[model samples]
Target: MVVKPDWLRVKAPQWERVGNVKDILRDLGLNTVCEEASCPNIGECFNAGTATFLIMGPACTRACPYCDIDFEKKPQALDPTEPSRLAEAVRRMKLNHVVITSVNRDDLADGGASQFVRCIEETRAVSPHTTIEVLIPDLCGNWEALEIILRSQPEVLNHNTETVPRLYRRTRPQGNYDRTLELLKRCREFAPWVYTKSGIMAGLGETDAEIRQVMQDLRGVDCDILTIGQYLQPSQKHLQVNDFVTPEQFAAWQAFGEEIGFLQVVSSPLTRSSYHAEQVRELMKLYPRQRV
Candidate 1:
């Protein structure tokens, strides 16, 4: 493996703040994708008193090669208490914007969509002023399950495409490229009032033309927000990085996305699906057209 570029280096997290956030999550028995997935931006995001809550698991149903979240064939049963615990964390953290995501629970009947709805409702009951964003799975392409979560009325609904189509089989073996887009398309149709978001990781052996095509494809579905970032191999066992995308290239894509009519695009080496996600609230502020 090559040494990570200087641009990828992150300053160590301030321990005091990191501990505070961790204490809350631990005390509440809540999990965060930040720690579970080994996200590089954990330091900065957590210190700022925000987190993308990883509900429904520390385990997933699919073993995507590019992901660090653990995969389980027969995951444990859902915890009814999780929603209230997550709500308490949001209240204690005093967050105005919260991101809640979960692992694919294909083992369940509703694909765990009910848990998302419960979390949304619980958070609102406790902190009505706070905005909610849900990063969800494809639900094995179950549109009905998707609708269940959508009806909860989250401010932003996100589902990551993760990688370009051609890489789906090898990188995301259990994932279908078209199924992902179709989910986003249906989300737009189901809740046009909600801001729709998707994410893609570069350095996975995809070409510029392919990336641009993805940006175009996302716009074709009326996707409101896009996030592009470099893919760092989690361990020697995981897929190796193909290339390190340069800052200039990320800047170029950011501009290109705007040209294609994406309401907001966050592209950078360190950017993750929910990295600096609280700032998504600014989209409506900066671009009135995004007020949908």
Candidate 2:
């Protein structure tokens, strides 16, 4: 039986002009993970004047049991002008840091790698000093495709492990735990200057030992940043929450991540991978001599 976690109270103030912003996104035919994934921190992020853009397309190629994104055999064609439009949005928002992510576009030849590069270039062209980060797919373990994005020189490259290896068959059937580790390892190898990052969700029936093992695997890959957050079930159709990890448990994990040598660790009940991204970018800037 799955243990139901206590629903934490979230009473973020509504963004007054959020609907206008949503309309703009809809008008441009763009998708945001914040909307699609039902992120609880959407109001806070939008109110603070930043949003993570989901590029390529919203429909995913793989159906992870924990996700609510639609899995369609064939998705819409890539938007050639998306890069420019995203740049325009960033400029309009006056954003100094941006996070670009995408659905698993396994059908594309370059795995939509080139588009990722284009978005970075366009963002930089319009906002030269803006720090950019990308939460990329594993590309089905395609190193060449990953290399394409790394070459674009984003400040941070993040991909999520999502859950423990034992749960892969149930949580992310299409994903491979070992392959994900290899991907993170290669990111560090390809772009030594770029800060490599990954995330994992707790309260998925994973034992404490299992979580520790996942952290060790990440460390083996030289993952510089780590994020641990409670996994809330997206919907009834998705995986049921096994437990609701408490705030204290999250704090313990944060301390453990630091003890394991992660340069930065963000673990909290309300933490998502992209939470406080602006602050993360600012911290990156402080370590100028360090890798990007």
Candidate 3:
């Protein structure tokens, strides 16, 4: 029998308002990771007035087993005007913080780096005071592409390790563990003034030691913010959950992360990488800037 954790049973506020948000996005003909990946926190995030914009296209070139994104043989053309449209959406939402991520476009020479830059420029043009966070891919470990994005200067540059290194083959077959570390390390190197962030999913058979090691690896890259959350299986084809991490365990991880010098750590059963991202930015503002 599959065990259901009590924490997952707690009632959350209704997110019917998200329907209105969805209508707005739909009328605009835009896609969101919250909707594409079927994120469990969509209701909470949307209800709280935040959303992670998905750009480039809905089809991802690389197929990660742990992810629920569709793999298209021939992905659609990049929208030249998506940045402005996204900026307009951000303006309409009146979001103080915005997170923009994209499907991996390995088909492009720059790996969608230019598109990221456009999104940043457009978002800043519209919402100058909004803090922008981007959850990015490894850019196929290309420093040039990564540099392009850093030059755009988002407030937070997040690239998820997703899971422990040992499960790379099963969880993210096309992804490289060391490459991801290099990506984060290079982000800090290229944009010393920008805050770096990364996240990992627990209950994917990652042990305490392994998770700790991942944290150390992230720190080695000079990552300033960290998020740890439980992995929920999106479909039968996706990776199954080995266990559901308890709220107390999540708290312990959060405390451990802070003790190890992470500026901010959000660890919980429902915590997603972009969850409470604005609050993370606010927390960082209280600290002394670290020399990159």
By how many angstroms RMSD does model 2 differ from the true structure? 2.0
What TM-score would every model get versus the actual structure? Answer: 0.97, 0.94, 0.95
lDDT of 1 by residue, 1-292 (tens): 4899999999998989999999999999999999999999999998898899998898899888888899954688999999999999999999989999999888888899999999999999999989899999999988999999888889899999988899999998999989999999999998887889999999999999999999999999999999999999998889999999999999999999999899889999999999888887787567543222
Q: Can you write out model 2's per-residue Cα lDDT over 138-212, one digit (the tens) per residue? A: 898889999999988998899999899999999998899999999999988888888888999998899888988
Cα RMSD for candidates in order = 1.7, 2.0, 1.9
Ranking by lDDT: 1, 3, 2
Worst 10 residues of 1 by lDDT: 283-292
The residue pairs in collision within model 3 are none
TM-score of 2: 0.94
Displacement of residue 241 (Cα, Å) in model 2 is: 0.4
| Top candidate when judged by lDDT against the true structure | 1
Worst 10 residues of 3 by lDDT: 283-292
Q: What's each prediction's clash count?
A: 0, 1, 0
What is the alpha-carbon lDDT for the whole of candidate 1?
A: 0.92
Which residues of candidate 1, in runs, are more than 4 Å off? 286-292
